[model samples]
Target: MVDADWKPSMGFIYGELRKATQEIKGALNDNENAYKPILDVIKEKSSKRLDTCLHMAAYILNPYYYYYDPLAKLDVEADDSIVEILGVLFPGDYELQNQIKMVELPMYKNKLEKFDRPIAIKACAVNNEKFDPANWWDSYGGSAPNLKRIAIRILSLTTSSSGCEIIWSIFEGVSNFKS
Candidate 1:
């Protein structure tokens, strides 16, 4: 059963996602190569840094993305949303952010398929209760506004104290797999 708070308004999310997809598409079309690095940043965001944000948004939004019967097969509008949101939410962070320069999960580095909502949901499920979002934010080195928004959303979703538990759990879970 759907949770009581799970308002099924995928349309709103989908609209935002679709817009992001269009923006990415436009960028790619304009320069073709100048914006390639942007794709890299987006990939990083989807796989590790902001995977929960992308996954949850897609889970809530993609249901309403309308399409004609012919082109329905190539639907990645959800993924596109994740990338776009990252670009907007983190204007210069992608380029400024230091690369981990490690190797274990190739999926974290160059695999887009590993970034689906199913993966994100599963990751969250395995986290223990001790996980705290505020601590996670501190670890990830987030800014004040970014951290605050994340805390609010996570607490709102997990329905816990307006403290750090829910956000921490989510951060730790999602951080385990970064590409």
Candidate 2:
């Protein structure tokens, strides 16, 4: 689920620890206090790294959340948050800021307007269909090139290196067996 190519799947990591802790607490019922310290540690660590700017931007760019799901409510401060990240990443780039104001923001607004339409509604309702958000951006990139660039960059990031560690462990196991 940490795969960079799967844009919609990337959001699964963002509150994962909190969700898991809540679920365990629910299951444990009266025993929750016994695990409070562990839960607190998980919450603390998750909060420290969970919602970085790239992750938030990826959520906004994900079609399943932003464009297709009418019930999905984006944070009200999303625009300002994205702008702040862009400012940090591209400081002193007046042209880029102008493009964000003139080009990207309008495109995002238009997409928001389209969210309640039949197409988006159907896309959201269909569970079996596999929609590639990157492909969608590829097809529509020409329409909003600057926004598309931002989406591509954010969505392409892997939130963690656990997958690489897993691969390394498997390789080590195989090498030890051979030795």
C-alpha RMSD of each candidate structure in angstroms: 18.9, 5.8
lDDT of each: 0.38, 0.60
* Clashing pairs in model 1, backbone N/Cα/C closer than 3 A: 108-179, 109-179, 132-168, 133-167, 133-168
Best by the lDDT measure: 2
- The sequence of per-residue lDDT tens digits that candidate 1 reaches over residues 1-179 is 11224432222232443346558869678575766677667666545433444444333222222221122224455335444554556677764222211221112223223323353323333223443323332332222334234333433333223345678888889999778
Model 2 TM-score relative to the real fold: 0.59
State the lDDT at 165 in candidate 2: 88
Query: TM-score, each model?
Result: 0.27, 0.59
Candidate 1 off by > 4 Å: 1-18, 48-63, 68-72, 76-179
- C-alpha positional error of residue 3 in candidate 2 after TM-score superposition, expressed in Å: 5.6
